[model samples]
Target: MKQQSSRTEEPHLSNVENPSRPVNSARNDVFPSSTPDNSSGESATKSSKSLWTNLKFVRLFMAYALATFGDWFDALAIQIMVAYRWGADPLIIALIPVCMAVPGILFGSVAGALADRLHKVRIMILCDGITIALTVGILFAPSPAWLLPLLALRAMMSVFHVPAQQALTRQIVAEEQLFQASSLNGFVNQCAKIAGPLLGAVVLAFFSPQICILINASARLLSGAVLWPLRRLVEKKEALVTDEHNEENQKEPETFFKQWQQGWKYLRHTHTVRNTIVFGCLGLMSILMVEYQFTTLFREIKPGNESMLGWLGSSVGAGAVFIILLLNRLPRLGYGWGLGGGYFLIGAGIAGLGWVGPDTSTAWIIMLGLCTGLGNGLFMVTMNYLLQKETSPDYVGRVFGIQNSLYSVVLVAAPLAGGAIIRSAGPSPTFQMIGLATLAIGLTGILFQRMLWSLNRRSTSSEKVGSAQQGVS
Candidate 1:
């Protein structure tokens, strides 16, 4: 079994034939020209790393953070609008996440491929523009029904926006600093989550939900404005043209099925990519289902569902913010344990929500909310760091696209399932079941860690032994 596993492994940096080459020689062929330097590389590498450290990365980080805030605010506004204004039937309420997920599954491959070929910033700007227009469309629409399709389209735009931004990060940041960049982004995302929901809820207190929607739209526009300045900092690489342009038509167009087939082929062949995608699919499904279901759970616990849902969600967000703040202090933690522990806690907390009194005091629910948030926040940061570090830049966008699509699928499915289960068993048992499932998944992650680590270690050791024997000969 060990030998079979060992044969499938790929080369990582610890397997050097001449360890001194990276230090002694001026030319380092390991990374492409886009990798940032650490003051040790040739002039370009040094310059690249220098750019990575400056205000550009900071600005881009803030831009995305603001955009994410807008996204979440819109989500809160929609839920409030549907529940309070439009009347909340389970199926109708479920349509929100479903709308978001459908486009992602349909458009992921095309969007990912485009991200690789086009300028990432330009693509992001385009998404922002379209989303802003959609927001305006929502503003003019006579009713909630008119807004659903627009929201769905906005979700599709998000699919492209995220991967493009992630790829752009790789273009500017140095390899060693990749983890730092990922952590920073993760922290910012959590901060946005913490602030957006709370702020949106506050806005809902005074203004009509429709006005809040307009503000969310405006925030997207502002986010695009912030990102505009980073266009120069992001160095553009000539795209790898996998398809020849048809001179007569001037379009390199492939059938949708054919494009999807190509994407599957790429994913199926790449082992680590395959694993990452699977992990993301499974993980995201659990996350989306649990949170969406919480809407009903909150309703059962407190008569006023919308307000309770927003407050509980905000509490979870607060827990996430706390986790992000602790990342710097907890650098010694391993990703495997950290992520596993997070999943476990989240599952356990949500399950415990059932045990909280029928009175549903703010104190106990708030505590559980914190646990749920912290666990999810930790898992997001660690898992993302692992995947980004493992995959090569060439396939990052496509792989992430697939992952995002799977995430959307899970998000869509979970709420429907949650609603069904809640209706059947009531909130207590439903919460318990979700909690158990989450804990089991976390346990599975923890149990599988040894296998993955063993494989990584064996590969490293084998390479060292090979180099030693070659040197002796």
Candidate 2:
């Protein structure tokens, strides 16, 4: 007689009974009486209010926002210093980003596994401390060569910091509030993106790069201090259960390589995670292509008007901020609608750029940028929220680690590919090609929505069962 594998058996049983149990259980356990009460509309309002009112959430949110702001601020300062002060060549300047990205490709999965095994809050604080120390090193760096390695080391710290922070968000916030929390986080990031560089520019106008680096280091130090208290909160909540889970995890005695492979295995088997990752990759590639061509496109439309490019960039940021704020106010939309619709809009907007030429109005060009940005903002928030929702707590860090590696690869490749296409076929055709490709990815998501949903249902069911078995054992 042939014997069936446990993995194959688990999904079949999961599909047959309690398909929604994992999501439901997460909500019920984390937020007592979180579900709406029939008699009182005010109760739901209060529940939503509680998330903002919670001291732990407020503290973490502020720390994360400050850290992000400092990062962007420091990045611009480095570019200015490298370009003007150090007299770095274009190739040297380019290497800065490449240095940051290489670590993600090499160490992302390993860092994620470590995040899963270690205390998340401590990991975040440790990473922040390292970043602060590295930032201070930049002030003393004698040459561009020295700075590049320090920047790479700083980037490596982020490889650990990001997954740990994300995993910790799951632990601290209620499941029902995850969407809003993620949205707020995205909002803070975008705000930092817009403000940080401007502030850096202002500082550079009056001060040396070293002063800006010092300010950035102080921000990092503040971030660590703010997070220091979170350890007590997390310890109180998960000490007993997490200790048991850790002990069990250690008992199996798996190698680091094997643990890293587990994340890939989970990603390969989980349909929702796989599809979302694909969709995100495609969407990001298309956006990057359009952005890379934007300067050329602007020059074609309005010859020699360099400052207009900044306005165009601002328009995109404004659009993203607008959409994020809108999503925060409205009821949460379904993942299928948000993902599919967002991509469709992004595709249409990017394709519209193909139509712009000398005859196109400046207002029209800005509008296209706004449209693409809005779609991007929608896609980012929805995909992140869904990823958090579908991923089990144990697997969150690993899944996000995989996502980071994939995104880093895309970030490095897309620009090179886009530039090649522009050189070979001109920017207009390249835009059209990227746009159509993005649209096709979105349409595929919409067409296969049912299958993806089914896969998520089965995966969630199996996770619940596995957790139950572990509890019993």
Candidate 3:
């Protein structure tokens, strides 16, 4: 429940009296040195301008954009190659995403631990380098069997890459700039989603899938190079070394299993993090259900016109972009309301698709796409901003890693379930069911706002008590 106004403040460290407790140990401490100096009286415009002018942040942003573009580019190329070139069956093609998701579910906690132990910049650069190599292997693959495993390996690399990249953001920007930075990052990602496929489709027309793969490889290489110079910014913390004074640290250094347990424990105890993950997972499941059925829905409305699907997808991206542009001008809605209200809109938009009949115009479908996109955009930005604001820097990677794992689990199952619903109940009823379920989850957040508010209040109160005890000591 950390609001946008609190973004300028450092993470509130737990002030538990028992130094031996996991919460008070050094492994859980926020980096005091990295906290931004928000006391300056500069104008909001000036502060934003200064953040944009920072060369380091600009380079990081470019690296993120390149990496995302490559992902989407390869995604579209692979799908086309498998379907047309390899003449793969639908079930085989479906395995692609499943393979990609498996690594996150299996290795997410381990990758997060590595991010915590190693230099995050090095982790990012190494992942990108591996991606480049994987893309090359993908280009030369003779069959779907060879290609699928390579794609999964590349996805595994990303399990390490993504958490490192997100955790690194705290080091790269000031506290006040976190929301703007997340917004801009989300904007670039959305743009890549729209542009990469269009560009890939164009490339596929004139060249081979191998050439598209090569382009993706080149993008990965460029992304790694962009991140290489960020080595200086990555904090080099000592990894779980034994401390003589602190009883918790005096014991043997925490094993990987212990660290993983700590991560789960943190997530369970942190109310804001727990709620966000639960509600976010629900929203994601509903969104993916709609997305998986999109082609089927499109065929019913406009048979044999796949190109119109692209237009509708692009409309969604446009809606996201519009929200990003007006983020600063928007009212200061708290996290619960922002997330809940956004999901409500998303549910409404998805359900609206069920109403479109044979005579429904293409324009109406595009508008519905826009509605869903806007809702998703707002929900994503707000959720990311709140997670960063609430989490201690030391634990950010692990928290994000855990969230990624849970998301992967939901993603892997959602499409299969959606397919079943579509087959059994028809697409329209399936949409209505998913949308209503999502809407109900969102409504819980809105109706229980006072409960969420109390969680935040209690968090703040505990921090104050901890600070007072330290002062007295």
Candidate 4:
């Protein structure tokens, strides 16, 4: 809704608010220095109209949406092949996620460091091209045993693809548009959740699961095609930032090993990155550990094994979509507050769920699902925006790579821990404890916000001092 600006051209460095702002310098990732919404309703409406019309952003976003859609179908297709075609037990079925997560755990940060050393647009296009071959190779996987390795290989490609995509988005979209653009992308993810599975179900009825694999392969092709133009558009931002950084240091690009090590070094110094990994990741972990308990809770309350999980899951998606829409209509909420608000809302929803009982009305339960979804939508949009805005383009790849690896770790471990706890201590206490811990993390955001404020002040002062030393002041 903040769309009323008149500029229609793709992003240029002149669009940056401060001409002398330090290139690739650390700033506030949690509390962005940008202003809040002051646009009139008419201006906001105009901005909305121009949002998707910006051709550079449109092309980049389209590539992402297609990849996401195809990825969903791939998940469905693999399950069908193993479960229905090969008669796999549930244990074998579970290995699919393990395969996907393993690549992220093993290679996520390394892939990100590699992305920074290459042209991000080329990285994306190359990865997609590889994905097409990998998806096709799945058709020939002689047995379920072979599927794991193939899937792991494909996921490794994607681990590289994600950071490149994130870096490319930053280089393509204007700074002011970062939050809105990310919000729109989040909508695409939520929509794909609803549409992808439905489309897979419909297609499977009419054709073999191989048909779905073929569609996924095609999606990867098209995603690459849409990105071809970005090779030029992204260079604009890279050239802008690299000129300053390159001039300050008169050496070849840091050796790959140094770049990789430097990424870890940056993570150590950057408290904002540390905060999210510690607090944000933990909050998400808490929910994942307790989330499946819903199925158990419902089973105890109802006579038949009929679960409201499908319906409740839909409610969560709907809630997420609703909040994303609402946020897009408003001007940028203060991003630092957005982080705090997102965590608080999510923790609140999870905590509330602990109190749900058999007597709770279906409507009330649906509302709680929506609540968590709202928090998730906000958290994701803010996290992506923060990474791009705060980190130098040189380092964002590694930052996101680090995040992906940590998230995958939680994805694999949290559920296993939850299952163990539920078997011993029971679901009720586990949910209550995890939910409360998440809520406490949310409250800690305020103190972290103040700490980040001081960090930003110190960073800004250091930049000025450095410029003076270089005779640029």
Every candidate's CA RMSD? 9.4, 8.2, 6.7, 5.8
For residues 1-473, write the lDDT of model 2, one tens digit per residue: 00000000010111111222343232211112346544445434544565666566777787888798898889888888899988989889868878888888888888887776677878888999999889999989999879989998999998888887776665555556777777888788777778988888899899888888898899999988987876644321122123356457646766766657766766675667677788787777776766657877767667777776777677777877898899877754656667776787788778888777767777887898788778777777777777766666556678788888887787778777887888898878888888878777777766766665444245453444344335434
Better of 1 and 4 by lDDT: 4
Screening candidate 3 with a backbone cut-off below 3 angstroms (N, C-alpha, C), the clashing residue pairs are none
Off by over 4 Å in 4: 1-19, 23-49, 232-249, 292-294, 303-307, 446-448, 452-458, 461-473
In angstroms, give how far residue 316 of model 1 lies from its true place. 1.5
lDDT of each: 0.61, 0.70, 0.69, 0.69
Q: Could you tell me the lDDT of residue 279 within candidate 1? A: 55
Clashes of each: 0, 0, 0, 4
Which regions of candidate 2 are displaced past 4 Å?
Answer: 1-20, 23-49, 235-258, 454-457, 461-473
TM-score of each: 0.77, 0.84, 0.85, 0.84
Model 2 TM-score (2 dp): 0.84
lDDT of 4 by residue, 69-186 (tens): 8988877888899999999887877778778888989888998888777888789899999989988899788888888888989999989998887766655455657667777888
lDDT of 1 by residue, 1-473 (tens): 00000000001211111222221122111112343343444434334443334465666766776677787787788888788877768667667667877998887776776666567778888888898999888777666678679878888888888777766665545454555566666776776666777788899899888877888788888978977765544344412222232122224454544444445555654444465457555655565555656655666666654566656677777887688567645535554565567788788788888676556677777788888888876777666655554444444566567777666666667767776777888887877877888888777767775543222323222232223222322
The positional error of residue 182 in candidate 3, measured at the CA in angstroms, is 0.5
Higher-lDDT candidate among 1 and 2? 2
Task: For candidate 3, write residues 51-111 as lDDT tens digits.
Answer: 5676667777888888888878888889988999999998889899899989989988778
Q: Judge candidate 1 at residue 95 and give its lDDT.
A: 70
- Please give the distance, in angstroms, between residue 143's alpha carbon in candidate 3 and its true position after superposition: 0.5
By TM-score, who's the top model here?
3
Error of 4 at 316 (Å): 0.9
